[model samples]
Target: MLMDAFVDILRTIIWPLAIVWVSYIFRNELRGLLNRLSLFKYKDLEAKFEKELLEVEKEAKEAEKLLDRSLPHIADNEQEKIEQLLRIAGISPRAAIMEAWREVECALNDVAKQEGIRVKGLVGNSLSADKLAQIRGIPRENTDIYTRLKYLRNQAAHVPDYVIEEREARRYVQLAIHLAGVFRLKPNE
Candidate 1:
């Protein structure tokens, strides 16, 4: 009777123990697989982000063309800064995008300062692109594009695990440069 009881107990516990042992043995591999799956799952989100960026880029190009007059040349120093950001994109795309957006913010802050708007600190206050646009009499379409760029920047900033491709980062930096140029224009220009 004891022998039969022991056999029954072994059968009940054996499969569960084997599964636990196997899981422990391949834990690191399983973790890596799950991480890859997480990235794959977010691929749709990445695609949508890229599509929005492309639309904003197109809008920025159209707006630039509509200006008719040439944009004021971006200074050599500014060009160097942009190039540095592009190089950074190769190492860390998220950091490059964030820095590019900071360039846009700095340009907006400069405009705000030009208009006698108080800028509080080094990084400056939270003066938005739309507010600066309205104050500077920028066209509504251009303002919309700037707002969308800010929106994309916010997404990149907030989503910790969001992956930005280097090319996408480059596109974002280019669009930011264009918008910053527009904001730097004289109020009547």
Candidate 2:
């Protein structure tokens, strides 16, 4: 009775699974046969799949660009905090603004180091020249954060008239947030 039951169980489960396996092994042939029966055209179906795949790729690229544009906004809170500190220190409005630019530059250089990015003509407190090949995956960018930061540091010793654009500020904020991820930071906490 036990052997009979085992065989019955095999008949119900194993046989079906074996048939499924065989069908799957010949799935392409079966699909071609079905297509030839005028049920559907494989070429049209394949083209539809390909078109959908291309659309998906296009959407992914757009999303990546949007994310890139959004990244620079991550440093806003930090900029606010730093500005408040400068204000509390009794610095002039212009001086406080320049200090904010310095923070951004510092953040960018620091982030580059964290990501192992190599930058050229890296004057002042910027990412060093030895970091390029390791992080070629990172895009080459020229943000005001880098230029203004270096400029501010240069002019900081003399006149405090360094100016940073609003766009640069936003970009640096995004960079700070991106770098934070590499270092395993949990946002502003």
Candidate 3:
């Protein structure tokens, strides 16, 4: 009877003990798997971001075609700024995306000022694509693309855990450049 009791105890303890031992032994592997899973999730997020940006670009291009005119060319200095932003993307994708969006913001503020619209706060601090679009009578389609770009920029800037890929960052910079060029055009032009 004692032997049978001992065997029953062993059976109950063995599985729990083995589980604890295996967990301890494979802790590092388990941690690595968790990290990889996190990275995989972020990869999926990055892919979705890229797809959304692509759709915005396509919409912008279609709008341009429908308007039967291309966005006016920005000045050489503006082109230089865009090139600098592209180079920055190679080093820090997040910074590049942020700076590229800043260019668009700056352009919007400048246009507002040129239109005699009173900018309420510090130069670029208070301006937004939406506000500028509403006040300046910008086309609805153009405003939509600008808003979408701003949304994507916020995703890159606000998501602490997200790592922006360099290629995607460059694409964002290109889109910002296009929007900035559009904003920089004089009303008469």
Question: Could you list the CA RMSD of all candidates, in the order they appear?
Answer: 6.5, 22.0, 6.0
Best by lDDT: 1
Query: What residue runs in model 2 are displaced by over 4 Å at the alpha carbon?
Result: 1-69, 72-79, 82-91, 116-139, 143-145, 160-189
Q: In model 3, what is the error at residue 138, expressed in angstroms?
A: 3.4
What overall lDDT, based on C-alpha atoms, would model 3 receive against the true structure?
A: 0.79
Output the number of the TM-score-best candidate.
1
For model 2, state the Cα shift of residue 73 in Å. 5.9
Comparison by lDDT, 1 against 3, better one: 1
What lDDT score is found at residue 104 in candidate 1?
79
Model 3, C-alpha of 124: deviation from truth (Å): 7.7
Query: On a 0 to 100 scale, what is the lDDT of residue 185 in model 1?
Result: 83
Cα lDDT for residue 53, model 1? 94
Q: List, residue by residue over 39-87, the lDDT tens digit for candidate 2.
A: 2443453354344334433543443453333334435776566456445
Q: Each candidate: what lDDT?
A: 0.80, 0.43, 0.79
Clashes of each: 0, 6, 0
Sum up the clashes in candidate 3: 0
Error of 2 at 156 (Å): 4.5
